[model samples]
Target chain A: MVMPMDGQLLVLAQAETGNALGETAPTIEVEEVGEPNPLTADEQELHATTEADGDAHHSDVFPPFDATTFGDQLLWLAICFAFLYVVMSRMALPRIGGILEQRKARIEGDLAAADYSRKKTDAAIAAYEAALAEARAKAQAMAEETRTSIKADIDGKRAQVEQDLARKLEDAEARIAATKAQALANVDEIAADTVQALVGQLTGEVSQAEAREAVSQVSKE
Target chain B: MADPNTVDPIHQFAIYDIFTLGDTGISFSNSSLFMVLTVGTIAAWLLLSTAGRKIIPNRAQAASEMLYEFVANMVRGAAGTEGMKFFPFVFSLFMFVLVANYFGMVPYFFTVTSHIIVTFALAMLVMVVVIGYGFARHGVKFLKLFVPAGVPGYVLPIVVPIEVISFLSRPVSLSVRLFGNMLAGHITLKVFAGFVVTLGSLGFLGVLGAVLPLIMAVALTALEFMVSTVQAYVFAVLASMYLNDAVHPSH
Candidate 1:
């Protein structure tokens, strides 16, 4: 397909160049009778060179389709590709793979470290909470113990005060009984004196012994 | 029809001798030069960028690594872990085609992959490896690739030939796809660019008229870039899939 197209292009280029040359030849011939045009000569040269280049390229053959060049292309491709394969497989690829692997390993290692740090932080938090709970429990237990000890001391003091109060009351009641008896004896003597006074006032001091004997006999009864 | 003097679209595909190889018909050519350039570019990019091997990648290093992993994953995905053995081969093919395609995008640069022979050679290499490795690994069982598991006996006569033909066409399709895309794209771009040049010479109005083609050329350039990369990826993917067939031929 490309071969035919190139052939057509070649024919067209030749035809166009031929027409240009044919047209310019008359112009140049006519101009030569007067003065040769430098610009026209330059154009002629350009066309000639282009035509020559077209011919050199094998006007009928497309470059890609040119079977003659295949050997060189293949040879060079083999050399270059083989060199490439070697360079890639041995040098370039391995290094790249290593870089990738190293990067992956590094990323994984970093991730794992981060995970470990997170775990350690979690453990620390757990330990802290455990210690906090233990301290709180210890404080609660100490408070309970102090409360019990203070209550026991207060109870003991209250019991001792009650016992002392009972003993004091018993002593006071005994003393009161002794005083009452002495007061009753004094009452009897006073009654006897009053009776003696009354008797003295009435019938003289002769009655003192009689009044005392009467008061003593009445108390005994 | 373009004036051959002003715009020879096919002129770009021409291979001229830079030097000769001792009277042998095999002379080094522009195609060869571009091939070397391709190789050099790939090697330099990969080697120089990864020379740092920093855990945190710079842009070039990241790009290279992305390419590596992309091809690696492609091989592994298509052919499985066992296909990783051919990772280097696939990587080489991918980079070669990719870099060659990109190189072609440079103005006035010879496109190595645009030639049928170059792409065909690369495809042949892939097929050779696949067929060779398949037979070596699986022996006569490699023929089982043509015989799918669930096909009925009667249908196999039809299915088997189709499978064989498809298998045979792998190189053809692979090579032609890259060659055709590169050739057509370059030519189209050249023609459009030629339009701008041809039209712009006419006058101010012609210059104004050339804007459409100029825009088209620009858009085509971007599209060509995409096509180049995509074609390379396609070639690698197909190669890996074919390798998969070689590795596990039963399917």
Candidate 2:
């Protein structure tokens, strides 16, 4: 499409050039006055020399004096400038601006997300700390309760053992006392028998009551 | 191989018809060719670079983006954010001038911006646009630009004329500055290049002497490159400044 249009433009430009030359030829002659057909004779000779230093010198760009060329330059500059301005304003700039804006928004979005995630992490840490602290406190209380109950159970068992030991000792002591009394009574009887034997030997006479009374008196003494 | 006597540095600026209509001196010349070249190159660049329109910038995209940002910053700095509406214009003008200036640095390429008429036309366009914008937006208030903000009543006459003259001179100064920079730099480069050609034709000893001019040309070429870029920047900056005045005309 563009190629076709360019070709069309080329044709149009050629046609326009023909018309322009026809239009400007008489004017160029009138302007020169001395050289009517300036284009004919010296054209090849001038081409032979690179400088073409005969009549028309190179246009000095320093002085902005050439009104004719100025108009032409301005005409083209305007067209070119307008074309550029349109491209820049309508197409190029907006695309760039869009990319830049999108990038900016993306960056801001990422930053915000980061901030939110950081907050979430902070909350999680706080929750974890709180839960850990609570668990520690519960464990400490449970330990205290277990220690107290265990101590009570041990105390009750120790007291029971002590009472049993005391009871056994009392029974043994009572029995020994009874045995001692019995032994003392037996000694009286034995002593009376001995007395009777001795009496019998001496006079052939013995009494159990008297013996017992005597044993009692001896035990009292 | 050409005659050194006939070596005309200013001949590079001559206009010749590409295809003659018959005898019209005014036909599509080298200047026109380069102008079209300038337009085509820029258009292709902008179109191609932004074609993919990726979020991550490629080299061409990055270059275009950088240029955009640079021009955007210039407008924002000079004219504030309001001046950004003129970004496209300023950017176009800057790129065109910059590209044309750089194009001129090529050995045989014609420097379009070297012509005073071209720069003046651009400057006039800026002036026209600014004035049009100012008047369109501000109405009669735009004329207040000629009035100094805090001038005494007795000094109003003197101050107003001076302000008006300065305002009128804005385009002239802007155009002349860019035109002068490009023209001078290119001419200087040409002169040095001419020196090399002229001196080298003499003999072996002369060829050795030509080395000095060749070095100078190389150095001047570097300077011209800088000048080209700076002039473009200055033109854009000045345009923005003028546009700023339009947006916010101080009485």
Top DockQ prediction, candidate number: 2
- Report the Cα lDDT for residue A114, model 1: 100
| lDDT per residue as tens, model 1, A102-212 | 777988999999999999999999999999999999999999999999999999999899999999999999999889999988999998998788878897675677999
Clashing pairs in 1: none
Clashes of each: 0, 3
Docking class of 1: acceptable
The per-model DockQ list reads: 0.31, 0.34
Each prediction's TM-score against the native? Answer: 0.84, 0.83
Q: Candidate 2: list runs displaced more than 4 Å.
A: A1-64, A173-206, B20-26
Q: List the residue pairs that clash in candidate 2.
A: A17-B21, A200-A204, B149-B251
